[model samples]
Target: MLDLPEDKILPGTTGPALQYVLVADEAFALHKHVMRPYPNKTLDIEKRTFNYRLSRARRYVECTFGILSNKWRVLHTAILVNPDFATEIVKTTCVLHNFVRRRDGLNCNDELLTSDLPTLPNCNTSRPSNAINTRDLFKKYFMEEGKLEWQHNFI
Candidate 1:
């Protein structure tokens, strides 16, 4: 846990506190800012729907990285340069990738979006109640007000 100062935690925004979280896979540890899908056991409709939605978002992210790595071969290997230069390299690649995509369009044969979902070992660690509650709230929202009509079909 980070021993952040109080001011860092509460930035004094005008409106209600917004919870920003990362959509991660099973390999990541769940926390207030990281949401992972529930275990693939005893899943009810709500859980299945949540998993489907989360997986769909994760797929887009994976596909983007796939395209980037295929285009910029430098990203495939470890970047041994200074941290600042590495950041610039990544930013530049993203800009160039978008520019090229807009101009030439995707040639899937050359820039194939390959996805390899790794099998993660079972994690027995108990997550904090706050994190669990946050995920539950999202699941409830997805099942109710925030649901897309076609989301049920995917589940």
Candidate 2:
């Protein structure tokens, strides 16, 4: 249902405009603009390391969604309203969520919210070579320059 343009370039990259990409799970296919974790169990250290870093970065997004869902119970249940209205409700909730978080500074306990939240659905699709290459580049970056101190423990 998400109608994203295939040609959109990602914002905020320092040099050269990279294609806008969505970080998703293995269930989804990678496109020129979408990056997913390397598939299967036989991945090498570099791939595993990449997956770990991606998962760590993805946790923040998941936590934000969890906070939004927790703060607005309506997101937990199926809304009977029109699709447009539902979109408006979600948008309003996001704005309000940011406002509240800014003013109150994340009142919810991180452990409780993150651990208890359900995983979001992935967009099922096939992997394009361009996306695979991009993922590899990101993986290399994480393995080299972008690694954190505690990342070795996971690998």
Q: Candidate 1 has what TM-score?
A: 0.76
Score each candidate by Cα lDDT: 0.78, 0.72
RMSD of every candidate to native, in Å, equals: 5.2, 4.2
**What ranges in model 1 sit over 4 Å off?**
1-18, 105-110, 113-124
C-alpha lDDT of candidate 1 relative to the true structure: 0.78
Worst 10 residues of 1 by lDDT: 7-16
Model 2 lowest lDDT segment of ten: 8-17
Q: What tens-digit string does per-residue lDDT give for candidate 2 at 1-155?
A: 56565553233334333555677666566776667788767999889988887777678677777778888878877778999999999999999878877887866453324445345667665567777777877777677656677888977
Expressed as tens digits, the lDDT of each residue in 1-155 for candidate 1 is: 44333322113323223366779988888887788999899999999999999999888888888889888988877789998899899999999888987888665354655756567885666799988877887787778766889998867
Pairing residues by index, what is the TM-score of model 2? 0.70
Q: After superposition, how far is residue 40 of candidate 2 from its true place, in Å?
A: 2.9
TM-score of each: 0.76, 0.70
Residue 141 displacement in candidate 1 (angstroms): 2.0
